[model samples]
Target: MLFKKTATFITAIMLSFAALFTPFPSHAEAHATNSYQSLENTINAILSDASIKSAMTSVTVRKASTGEIVYEANADRKVTPASTLKLLTAAAALETLGEDYRFTTDVLTDGTISNGVLNGNLYLRGQGDPTLMKKELDQFAATLSKLGVKKINGDLVGDDQWFDNIRLSPSIDKSDETYYYAAQISALTLSPNADYDAGTVIVDAKPTKKGYKPKISVTPDEGIVTIVNKANTVAKGKRNTLSIKRQHGTNKIMVSGNIPVGSSKREWVTVSNPTAHTLAIFKSSLSSKGIKFSSTSKNVRRQAPDTAKVLAVHKSMPLKNLMIPFMKLSNNTHAEILAKTMGKKVYGEGSWNAGLRVMHEYATSIGLDASEWHFEDASGMSHKNKVSSAQLTELLLLVRNAPWYGSFVKSLPISGIDNRFVGGTLRNRLASPSVKGKVIAKTGSLNNVKSLAGYAETKSGETLVFTILTQDHKDSTLPSIDKIATAITTTPIY
Candidate 1:
């Protein structure tokens, strides 16, 4: 039986790879066996198990220094790449924009400030900084207070020209409004993954005088949503729904629900309406600051006149640290915004559509065959992107040699524990028992789809680049996150 196969087109596509890497030695006895055949057999065993029949798997393992494919299974079957796409984005960014790139947000006053009032318009301009919210914005507002300006004489505007335009993915439907997938990226998304602008209710269940009824405040980000909290804490580990709804263009936030008193302020995990929540927080913050202005916020249509007086300026957290957390934690919003930032740097706009084209072009120039790969969005939130396992492995191999490898490795999580952070990765079990901590890659999961790609250094002094992508719908039984992870960790490639 054909355990692994590749089309002529794929081999021809790989011919281009010759310019990128040299072939590996056939007898690097340091691996699990003397040659690639034994490794191939092991991979076949793993892929052929009856339990794996339902999975749609495509994989490729290559000696990193020599690009020699040790084992492969459906290496050319195109499938969803998920967040692994971040690697390409990260690569393009590292090569074209350099690792020290930073996104900036500037505050400008169309007029001058005097006697606690801005004589002209107040403009909040952004260059698509994803981390501009709450604390950052609060600090910005505070600086204006010190400048002897308690009020704005004109409109409080939002200048987001860094992005050509912003819109939601048409792939999502109306029901997805509250889901993160339906979020609309802005030049000023503020918190990563749309955290703060996603509406937060200060659950004041602290034994109030009103017989313990929770006090919910209306601070919708987009200003038109209602939060219905059906959550009431009963015991430890008890969970309920924190639902939110809204009509377009309204500032009224209605929250009704029961919450268990944790004896502390708790952030219950729940979906949020990002757009409405952002607008709400902005309104609330401005109101509390006594910056008297109408509820109406006009999008700054043109650049704040260069002659515009300078009142205040705000900066986001450093990009270096942000990139690690975004990649290691697999932050969808941050990844999307990062790609958008690339678009802005390259073409002066942050549209995902534009950024995506940029990513593909970069990959092609790096030796990937355009006919063998496809991409839709940088975030991988959409189900439209596709790429083969062999190609993925090849890409990772290139990234391994890139100058930004350290920052790249720091982006993936570790194994065994940790839900969405710290501990969720495949260990270096098979390659080198002591070769742990050397493999750093991204893990992806969407419905029946699963993917793992990264670099591995073996005890035999060999470094390997690998990618395993599985799609199982019928008899698809996942190997408990830990076991599947172990398989990757334990691969004896070192």
Candidate 2:
């Protein structure tokens, strides 16, 4: 009887020790485990889709409040991020340039005005404002008109020295040059519309009577680009094979092929030299304002003199407001312009090298390992840009506490929202009842590459940060990606 009592006592001590080492999970921990497991299962099922099987995909999801990773799949594998890289660019810009920053275009004159005539050169100096429109140019002309500038005896000079002379990123594909998204970067540039596609013009080809040439018109036609119309308006129901191309190294745009009688086509065609284009438009605005230039006055590209007088200045909308169109429309030109602006702000040189250095510094400050990734251009137009999903999620988490976080979040595309500024690239995606309005993200695509990254609000009222990067897929994987995001939103995490 004594021996039996001793054995029981020893067993009780052993049980106590075991319990100390392996205590039961707390309520919060238990909930987290179940939530993570559920998310993993849901995401894995979507990733197993046949369409995504051939693609190299990476995914990472984290709890925003705790930075706890909920799920990851090949998260460390580096792949081209496509336009999702804009997320990094956007954050870096907000941090480096601040939300209240504004880009400015200034009108300066080297000569004195007397009796309503400028005695010397009239200068338009651009400081990398991508939002400069014809209306703003008209305003500049009006300001000059108010300043008694009636005629110019010297040259009308364009000063784009704020940035380097390199018009296109070295890593850009040659085929993308004619498109507005690949428009050349210039400190002095112009946009045709409120969408603010700088360095390009809007070409509209409306079909006229059947078998006749379609009426071709260019918006804000400042005579910088010459249009060659070779397209014909075919009978109704005919195939519209119309094509518009701007020849390489020239401002000549060729429009060819047939359009159906009722069909009209519009294209945003990039100009060869944006600085010269701005000069032409400004001259036109000046003419409209009744400001005359002598026949001997030339249009030239030169730096403004230090002693030049500031006649007028046009300030862009704050960086916070600019973020709406920039992130919503995935504006590549805006990304590049911001990058160069950062370089100019920090290193006193507006070159990609300087700008990327600032971006790298900002990334490192946000706990991202800058050495692990490569980005040749601020805009992900270059396929050389590479980033892992894990790194992107890390970035997304750290930026949550930023002062500009609200602006940043507001800039992302909301799923199922039809408004272009609100829905952006995600307008028609993930529109099912369970997922609509739950996912806010950036959508990315390139040849054989796709990505989506941002935040998802779960049913449990938790915000989850996620990044999905896919590359080299033969088929479209956007549907599968959307399903994965939907799963994240609907899965019970609590």
Candidate 3:
């Protein structure tokens, strides 16, 4: 109900602003009476309108075909791109790695195998593919079982050296530990959150007179170190604090939350170590299927000196499908991994800076003026990032002509109803009758900044590129700022 109320309230505000541009007052004597004559003029007029003028910090619009400027309001100023920065990563990936690219991870056994028993350690290695998950890990284990690997008397080796070592949450504020966003980014993150792994929780609990507590078990895979706590849910519509801790070799997640009487409830909480925990679960599952390991797995420091050689490789979904999730969800992990993977595929090791260098070079080669854009991370999770509206539009323009444009652009979230854009007017309006299927753009937002950049097709089928960036706008003023962006795109021009 709270979420719904918030959504409704925001919608009302947006609609109110949407009504402002319906009919600009034409009778003001000494007003900023700017005639809506040409596309550029109308764009400028709407941008300058008092209703939204205060919220806007900068904006830019351009034609894709001739590289002509259609509108500009502080177009050259620098501002944070937020998640919209994924566009650059995606574009660079398309040009350097192509659309058919894929990320691969492998599992190898180091000790010689005799019959159903392995004489050595089992190795879990990642090839910089960001999509590595539990399901994928499970499949590999299933394969190991078929090879008659009943037991391994050695440690499970986890290797993430395929890419340069990196930690998660380099920029997260420590005070915000309550959020998953605060967790650092890492090449080898095993269940960073002890109780949950990337939103995956194992629920095991039984109902009691006081609450569900006795025999409730929510233990993560053994490889993960756990932290336990006790949470009590008093009533409906509230979350309880369950006892959660990882001591020795176990993570116990006990819940004392309220539930409907006679109700069987289960849910997957976001498990933090998602990557490592996933591998741990896969190993355990494989063990259940006639495979056994007599020793706990250890994080391997370097490549195994004499490890089981890999005979086959399983590639993940094509870059196209993956990028879709990356763009639609604006996943920081996915974007970073893709950038690093692209760099590794081209220059090896997939260093963030290496891939960034490659991306900047490619952007320049494509004739996009990247003079003002500088990136420290592929995913624009940090405020240190900088970009210009013109550069963003130029990126869209470059993506339109690139060979991998189809997958890269198609992956971008549409205006109205994707993961984040659900019921949004600024983006959704692009799918409305006035601009239906005419624009494909990405939106960016920070504390006081909002931006939209992408391509639109004219009624004549010509592609148009535009980018709008508004920084330091007050919260109460965002509605008008959003309206200004919509007005520029949807405001009818004679």
Candidates' C-alpha lDDT: 0.57, 0.87, 0.58
Q: How do these models rank on TM-score, best leading?
A: 2, 1, 3
lDDT of 1 at 344: 73
* lDDT string, candidate 3, 1-494, tens digits: 01233565456434422321122221211211133235566566766766557764557665554556666777778888777788898888877877777766677766777878888777776665555555566677778777778887787676667667654435544443333333334444433222212323455544444443334445444545343424333444444434332221223333443543333444443344444655566667676676776756453445544546772356767777666656765666666766677778778765776778887887788776667887787777777778888778766755665567667666665554423433222344444554533456676766776777776544443445677776665653345444544555565444
In candidate 1, position 322 carries an lDDT of 64
- Show model 1 residue runs off by greater than 4 Å: 1-36, 192-226, 229-303, 417-438, 459-461, 474-494
- Residue 78 displacement (Å), model 1: 0.8
- Which has the higher TM-score value, candidate number 2 or candidate number 3? 2
TM-score of 3: 0.76
User: In model 3, what lDDT does residue 239 have?
Assistant: 46
Error of 3 at 229 (Å): 4.6
Report residue 106 deviation for candidate 3 (angstroms).
Answer: 1.3
For model 2, how many clashes? 0
Q: Candidate 1 residues 194-290, lDDT tens each? A: 3332122322222122224454443223233444443344432334233334323342333334444443233312124333344445545666677
Report the CA-based lDDT of candidate 2 relative to the real structure.
0.87
- TM values, all candidates: 0.77, 0.93, 0.76
Model 2, range 148-224, lDDT digits (tens) per residue?
Answer: 87899899999999999998887767788899999999999999898899999999999999879999999888758
